[model samples]
Target: MSSPVRYAYYSIAASVLTLGLKFGAWTLTGSVGLLSDATESLVNLAAGMLALWALLVAVQPADDGHAYGHGKAEYFSSGAEGVLIIVAAGGIVWAAVGRFLDPQPLDRLGLGLVMALAASAVNWFTARGMLRAARRYDSITLEADARHLMTDVWTSAGLVAGLAVLLVAPPSWAVLDPIIAVVMAANIVVTGVGLVRRSLGGLMDKALPEDEMRAIHEAIRAVAGQGALYHGLRTRKSGPRRFVDFHLLVPGATSVARAHTLCDAVELSIVSRLPGTLVTIHVEPEEEPASFDGHAVGGACAGGGDCGSCPGAAD
Candidate 1:
């Protein structure tokens, strides 16, 4: 088993532990806010399992059927987690509304708060560790799990603080329980929507971030040195991997071996700058008018001396 998959196991174990604590707290106190926290923990458990599966699939080597590898599996895990979170949020809102309609007196506030605090501590430590691992491995599944765990920690803390206020206030403020749950639900919905959007962007092959794109350009320029131009630059990311494609224009008199060597230097530079990056360079003779025919972004232009239609113009 890989290190990242082991982190997923830790996440699952933490989820189970936190879920037990939070659920016990909710049962003892009958606080809707605690109930919401417990519900999100349930979602966390499901997400961790899904993330484990995704990591397993994502780490698989490329095969004949999947020439690009299985990296996109991580996106499916995150997207499903997002959907589960939204569904859990809906359940929370429903429970909160019912609680608001028929208020109930909370019990064993001291014990319930202690349990919630304990659960939050577990999640805090687990999330911190998973976050570090996620950064080290560049695993989206681990990052999503870590971020969701952090959200649960914050939610539990907020619930504890709200219920503590109830311990000192009048019974009329019991409505605050449901109010806090509703607020927690809203926050979860926002997180869910954001995750879903990011997943869709990944599935849609969204371009690499500007900083990485700039790095690619800089690498090419440094390696190609003088009397060279490049265009039709494109880039995208899949899980931990990055893909970069561009056309490198060298002098027409340059030999094929020299052009090939230039391409190798450019690829090495880019990979050094951005690890896990796969660069594909199309070598073209600078003096040939046909070399500028097919630009990736805006297609061919009528007058093609780096016109507005060319992506290189903007670069």
Candidate 2:
């Protein structure tokens, strides 16, 4: 397995442990807020397992069926996680509402608070590690998993606060517990929507960022020289890989071998500048001569012929 797969496995194990601890704590305390936290952990458990599967599939080499590779599986995995989070949030809201209508006597508030605080600390460290790994590898699935854990951290913290309020104040303040649960559910819903939006963009094959497109255009132009123009620039990202394809228009007389070499050089340069890039260059003949007036020109041959007095052409 690759490093990404290994990291995902560790994440899944950690999430499972967290789920068990949170559920146990909720059972002991009978706190609605702790139950909400536990429910989110259940979602995290599912998301983490899916992310591990995605990581494994994503790292697989491209085959005949998936010529562009299996990296896009990460997007699907993250999107599913987002949907699960929304569902978990809905469940939390329902539970909180029920508790509001029929408030339960929460016991061992101090113990519940301590357990939640410990869980929060564990989530904080684990989430940070997951995020750092995801950023380093540019793995969207891992990043999404980390975000789920981070949400758990916040919810757990909120649970602690609610428990504290309930313990210090009289029974009249029991409403605070359910209220905090509702607020946490609302936050989770927002995160779920954002994740789903990102997933849709990836699945739709949205164009790469403007800055990335511009950088690629510049890279191609740097090598193609005057009278050469690039078009049909398209780009998309999946997991950690960036897929780029474009058309490069060159002089009609340019040999196939030379054009292939130029494309190779440009691809290499781009890959060096940006990691995990797969480039495809389509060579097209320029139909019209390019103007040189007021624009800086490079490698333009005189007399409109090759092997002549070109400004930057090799002898």
Candidate 3:
């Protein structure tokens, strides 16, 4: 009933409808290109189902056994979808090669083309909606699904254009149909590889985008005060959640209560800028003699170099 779940359902329904339409087109015209398009839709349906389940799992509250929640499960779904896409492309290549060699004439061109167009239309609209929802909620699973659907729309468009050309071109150009199918396979291969790479990146705990990092910096700058410095700023994203950790250096003379207040203000500012962000600030007394970047420094550290007033300290 959540927006992501609803979008998943929409994806499943659309895939089913488009699958039927595309296969019908393939059956009517015996075009291998249409068959390949239908096969991708079939992959879409399976992936959409997987995405639905993943979304459900991801929504579950974190438990004692799994403190970070089940959001990473969505990445696995997308990775599997990417592998499935590659398999679909392989199937397409095999079918295309056979058709290219045999050179069979297509039939009922008009109806098949119309059906293909209808399927593309559905994909185009669904992809747009999914993308909007994904950005709004910061759900990578939905975003992956949207990207997959958009690829399908492009595949459908290429097939439609190729088939239309086949209808009027010379007999020598009949080979164009299978060739177009091969080209589409290549296109989807790139899409699949991209999805896989993104899946791995997410699973490996990639940092947040530059824009998000900039926002974090802005939030910190807004709350940071004189004699307060930050270091070891780190950020990572897992699905809709963000984790941020940094060391906050403050004047050692500052009271614990005041430091806590400052920490709260900075944390709240970051959370406001980035929803679902978990911030951890380690307060360090600037007056405390501590190591800075492996160098033993005096209490009064500007954070870049050693303290000036301490023995054996750098200028």
- How does each model score on TM-score? 0.94, 0.87, 0.90
Please, what is the whole-model Cα lDDT of each candidate in the order they appear? 0.86, 0.79, 0.84
lDDT by residue (150-248, candidate 1, tens digit) is 988888788888889998999899999999999999999988888898898899988777677667767877877643567767677788988887777
Index of the highest-lDDT prediction: 1
At residue 254, candidate 3 shows an lDDT of 83
Model 3 TM-score is: 0.90
Q: After superposition, how far is residue 61 of candidate 1 from its true place, in Å?
A: 0.6
Model 1 misplaced stretches (Cα beyond 4 Å)? 294-308, 311-315
Per-candidate clash tally: 0, 0, 0
Candidate 3 yields a Cα-based lDDT of 0.84
- In model 3, which range of ten residues has the least summed lDDT? 291-300
- Measured by TM-score, the strongest candidate is 1
Better of 1 and 2 by lDDT: 1
Sorted by TM-score (best first), the order is 1, 3, 2
Candidate 1: give the clashing pairs: none
Candidate 3 per-residue C-alpha lDDT over 1-315 given as tens digits, one digit per residue, 9 for 90 to 100? 777889999999999999999999999999888999999999999999989998999888899988988888888988888999999999999999998888888889889999999999999999999999999988888988999999999889878987898788777777887898999999999988988988898899877777887787778878885434665566777778899877677787889999999999999999999988999987887656462322332222224322343322442
User: What is the alpha-carbon lDDT of model 2 when measured against the actual structure?
Assistant: 0.79
Decide which is better by lDDT, 2 or 3.
Answer: 3
- Residue 170 displacement (Å), model 2: 1.8
